[model samples]
Target: MRKTEKIFEVKDFPYPHVIVKDFLDESTLDLVIDALAGLEYDFKESDLFSYWASIELTDIDHPAINILRDDLGDEVWRKKVAKAFGSKSLSSIDMAAYVYGLGDFLLPHDDQVEERIIAYSLHLTPEITEEMGGSLQIFDVDNNNSKLIDSIIPEYNSLIMFEVSKHSWHQVGEILQDIQRLTVTGWYHG
Candidate 1:
């Protein structure tokens, strides 16, 4: 089924989250990905904590990016997200495009901030597999003793959104293959 016809699947394991496959139509997804590929990205590496290529979308003027930001900021989508995560104050959206190549990884961290209520990632990598190794790993928050709870593979046109709190600790596993693990990630501020 198309994303328009499918309801978001709610999952409550290590935390409350939702996953939506085929989040955008093929044409739109293609446009977004193409736009992302054309942008200049900066390599970011922070010792053992994080490493990736990223491009901020705040000042970009591309049509596809604009459309995506508008959709994400729309009241309808925000309402759906708010209801799904049981939050009534999801208000603003901030985003950036990321590319995780070989050896790139993000360490476990909770996305808790004063205003951030929801965190989301829209995967745009094509033909990714488990062997590629750039998966989103969620952990059971146990202070300094967190344990792995789940690992979600990066699937093309798939979206994952979760409530941002002290317990929402997660990480991106290192990419073992020489391929791009691209995604649009952001947070909805309360």
Candidate 2:
């Protein structure tokens, strides 16, 4: 048997996963929010102006997505994620932005694809409260166990990365009143 030298260690989150936080600086986060907020007037009224950004999927070469990967690929973020996965290979990387009055709620589902992906959600909201109901539920499909990962009454800049697979069935609770669920989520491609 070959003895493997493990540098990164994957975590067993409630849904059989792992996570990494605080991948961006406050100033950078501010800049991103500013850029994202500028698009409000351009979008339709139904889109509701709040604040959020997402890593473009279809346009694999989108400029904004390039920026996200450039920023996130920084040594700091990479090292942290490497330590978590106990490996350096990441399959999916994306960013999403959300602000006040986001109407839709993410329903329970698993990320199924031929290629496995690691799910990631970065936090930019300055504050989040339990009643806001933006918590994420990760179900242990195998054991039927579950975990409610609450969003922090967040600070300036924080990121959450996780190992998500087909079994990673998850959902987002509803947002109460008029609030935001500002976050970025994506999966690895490898």
lDDT of each: 0.82, 0.52
Superposed model 2: Cα runs more than 4 Å off: 1-10, 40-67, 74-83, 98-103, 143-156
Error of 2 at 190 (Å): 0.9
lDDT of 1 by residue, 1-190 (tens): 1245344667887888877888887877778888888888887878655455556686778898888887666677887788877787677798998888888899888888889888999899889999999899999977688889889997888888888888899999999999988999999988
Give the range of the ten consecutive residues with the poorest summed lDDT in model 1: 1-10
Which residue pairs in candidate 1 collide? none
The backbone clash count of each candidate, in order, is 0, 18
TM-score, candidate number 1: 0.93
lDDT of 2 by residue, 89-136 (tens): 653444445543444455667767655546666555667766776666
What is the alpha-carbon lDDT for the whole of candidate 1? Answer: 0.82
